[model samples]
Target: MTKLSLKSKVDFIFIIIIGIFAILVYSTRNQSQLARDSRMIVHHTSSINTVLEKILSSTIDLETGSRGYTITGNENYLEVYNQGHKNLEIWLDSLRAMNELNRGQVLKLDTLERLIESKKQISALTIKTRKESGMDAAAAITKAGRGKEIMDSIRKSVAAYQNQSVKLLSANLNQSEVHVKSRNWNFTLFAICTFAILFFAYLQIRKNTERLILEKIIQTNLMTELTVQNQQLNDFANITIHDLRSPAGNITSLVATMEQDSTLEEYKVIFSMLRKVAQNLNESLNQLIEVLHLKKNKIIQQELLVFQDCYSRTIESLQGEILKSNALIKADFSQINSIMYSKIYLESIFQNLISNALKYRDPNRRPEITIHTEITKQTILLHVSDNGLGIDMSKNGSKLFGMKQIFHNHPEAKGIGLFIVKTQIENMKGRISVQS
Candidate 1:
């Protein structure tokens, strides 16, 4: 498992907190919406009940007024009967307006309205019969009216509707209660989770503070050790340049004077070989001096130069040697540019590799030096290859870059060129290797 950093853990907790907050908001909104729907259901049911009561009251008024008119022949009673009929129609119209409640409720409503209409028609017929004819005709009309059956039906329908409305109201109340309970539980969970998140965040902050202090102490100790090592390295470089390089310079001067003496003719080949050996030794010593000086990982006035431009400078410095050897120098830096590198060291590196190619050129073939660079996963690599007298890996591979170890019998085969290249590469924390 990958371990999470402090920041990652904090972010994860923050995300969790946001998610919980969102869920709580959604839950609360859902609960509120449910409450609204429940209220609407109750209100609709109550409105239906009120309309039914009005219809019942109006029917009672019509019954009393019609009976009073038949017995006492009162004009005021007829007016009451007319007004009750009008009120009945109004109440039924109100019920019809809310007819979209439920399919069963609408069907029940139709039956109740039909019963009320039947009662109104009978009452109107009975009153007309008593006014036109006599008590006997009105009695006959009453028998046909069937008022009791119609009233019973109206009552039964009203009761059924009331019962259904009550059931619906009860169901809505239960649903609202459940929503409220769920919302409360969710809010409780949110509060508990929020508290836990804060507690863990506090602990994580404290742990991070302690870790930062420890890291600072470690960094300070490391800095002190690095300072001591740097001083020791500087002392070592001065000793190598002063104490070791002076003897090599003196040896080179002695060999040059000995080479000029005319009396050494009988042993001229020996002297020449001795001079070559001393020069190689002196050159190798000078390379050691340079390596010591450059061993420190310090770039003095470092510059960012184009790789192609650096190669051009090196080629210009060795123009005579390149032409005399009939050498072809090729370079490619097309894919990348402005690579930050030490200009002086880059020029030196390029010069040594190119000059060695010319000096060690094969007798039968002209020298073709190819210098290129490419980026790898870990670092940028600089490659210098030549189609000249290449080193015989099977013979001189072990000493290819060793001090004073020569690969070819060429005059400049002091083995210091690649050593200098390797040292400069090391100072920059880079690796150098050869495939052949």
Candidate 2:
């Protein structure tokens, strides 16, 4: 059995209690109604029995009077006969009234009415015989037993009708009891199913809530770890840049002093080589500093910038290096007139691309490079290409824009230039693509 959560368990218990209470209430109400019905049935049956008894008593009285007149041959016995006849009429009316209340008793009433009429006819004949002849003749007529035989037949019919009424009453009572029992069972089963559904729903809600809480906790921990790692990387970059600055400065100063003393030719060549190495190192240091600045924060507070003016300034900065390499330079700015960007960032991008073209020139070929812009509905497209030592697409394609990944064996290649370019583009919510 899987363990249920606190809320789920509470809901389960609550639902079960509610179900039990509902069943008790419903069963009590149903049983009360069933009892009321049973009482009504019993009341009707008792009334029918009372009517039946009255009719039977009247029949017995008529029979007795008929026999009495035959035996006594008196007018007083006729009085008894008349009284029984009147009572029979009254009982029949009462039977009819009772049957209106309980229609099942109608058959018994009909049989009783027929029997009473036959008895009345037989009593009238007895009276006639007593008045015409003597008591002996009436007695002989009674003893002949035709009236008794008719009475016997009437009694049998009444008994059959009573038996049928009794059977019908018993069947109705049994059916009513069974129906009440079946309703009780169905109500109990429905309550159980409803409680089960509520309990399961509560369990699912609690499980999902718990899972969400755990996921949030894990995400918080991961974010905290990443923040600490970023801080450590920033600290290391600062320390390394501070340590390298002094040595690079001392080397540049010593090479400058040696180049100024030009008495020895071989020493001058050695000093020039040392000066070039120092210049390269200084460039590498400057690149590192720029990258660190970008990593700290690329967004700068700046005034509106004109792209044409910025491009002209960047080209002027690289004019000497471009002239030395004899590189062909083409510029196009007709489509995009200007954009809002930091002038330093734009200058850095232009200087890096132009310097790389000059530094990575194909030894056997003339250098050529192109820079241009195209505007669309949503964005401005910038293209920078070179026919110098173009990138070897197969060997360095994937890592071309990665940080600190050098492609050609150029002395001035620091590999951070294109990486910075890509980062700057993305920081402005722009995109960059390279092709060879």
Candidate 3:
């Protein structure tokens, strides 16, 4: 469950839903086709019945018109005969067309068509006999009963066709009833299955949400505890640095006083060394205090500071060292001369890097430290390159920014400068790197 991501789970649920919906669509389409077929059957049956009745009615009209003309020799009876003949042809054609699908009905319709034709021929013969011979002659043809036989046959055929159509209609209605029931059942089953899947998905989502909320609460509590512990550690570190500063100052003062009182030439060298050690200790302590102060204020106010101003201050502070080492320092801030940063951090960074370069200068050549700024699409870059007794990266790269990690054998190699610089940069959400 933990291995499955939220997107994967959601996709799986949707796949199931889509599969079910596709099945429902296919099933409903088949049911709809069944319903459509039932309706077509019902319509065909009704049309066949109507055409059979009309054929019977038209035959009756022909028989009545021929009989009337045989008795009275009326021309109106001939008109009825002509109209009935036209109606019979039309009704027969319609039946033939409609019954094409049913072979049995086609056979019945063929027999009915022959019977109607025969009935029309007899009526035509009687009418011709009445007009050409006389009423007596027409009566003689009708008296033989051939026309009545054909009429009875046609009636029987029509009744049989209508009965078959009624049966077909009944069967289709029953089948349609079954299809409707099946469709209802399918819909109910589909509804139940869809609900089940949706309910299961809902439960899974609720469970995942609850678990996430619990994890978030646990994480928040841990963070709160960590913040409190970090604050306490900072307080302890500040107190320790404050206490240590006074002793380091006393040592510096004592060394300075002892140096002034020295009388012998040999003692002068000892005093000078002693004074250097005390001064170095005081500086280290001061640097440590500065680092502690940086920790105390995690978020410091930033102001726009000119790169040239910070560089000048760092150079002025290290004037003595620069002159002693015969260092060549140059800077180019043409691309970006100013930045938004903590003044203390920027000045300390310059002071540390420049001083280290001077301190670790190659004795064979004059120290050359080049500082420049560059602007890229995303960020402003500051480069500080130096020609010094370079570090062996493979040996001391990992420990370069570690406190008290000395790589050089110089007397002033406290190893805290790089560490402090790294800390300051990181606090400002910036990073520093070195290459040799």
Residues 1-436, candidate 2: write the lDDT tens digits.
9998877776776677677768767876776687568646644654454455455545655765666566555556566567767877886787687577656567656766776677778778777877888767776766776776777666666557656655655655565555455554544455455445545654665433454345456645655655554443433333333323333333334333432223445443433443343333444445444444554463354457777776665554454455456778888888886777755566556766776787788878888888888888868887888877678879888998887789888765666777766755765678888788
Q: What is the C-alpha RMSD of each candidate to the true structure, in Å?
A: 49.2, 55.6, 50.8
Q: RMSD, model 1, all Cα superposed?
A: 49.2
lDDT of 3 by residue, 277-310 (tens): 3333334445444544455475466889999988
Q: Write the per-residue lDDT of candidate 1 for residues 346-402, one digit (tens) a residue.
A: 766776777777878888987888888888784677888988777778888787766
Query: Candidate 1: where are CA atoms >4 Å away?
Result: 1-8, 140-145, 206-436
TM-score winner between candidates 2 and 3: 3
lDDT of 2 at 324: 55
Q: How many backbone clashes does candidate 3 have?
A: 0
Give RMSD (Å) of candidate 3 vs. truth. Answer: 50.8
Which residue pairs show collisions in model 2?
none
Q: How accurate is candidate 2 locally (lDDT)?
A: 0.61
Model 1's TM-score against the true structure: 0.44
Pairs with steric clashes in candidate 3? none
Model 3 residue 204 distance off true place after TM-score fit, in angstroms: 3.3
Pick out the ten consecutive residues of candidate 3 with the lowest summed lDDT. 240-249
Candidate 1 residue pairs that clash: none
Q: Estimate each model's TM-score.
A: 0.44, 0.38, 0.44
Candidate 3's error at 329, in angstroms? 99
In candidate 2, position 148 carries an lDDT of 67
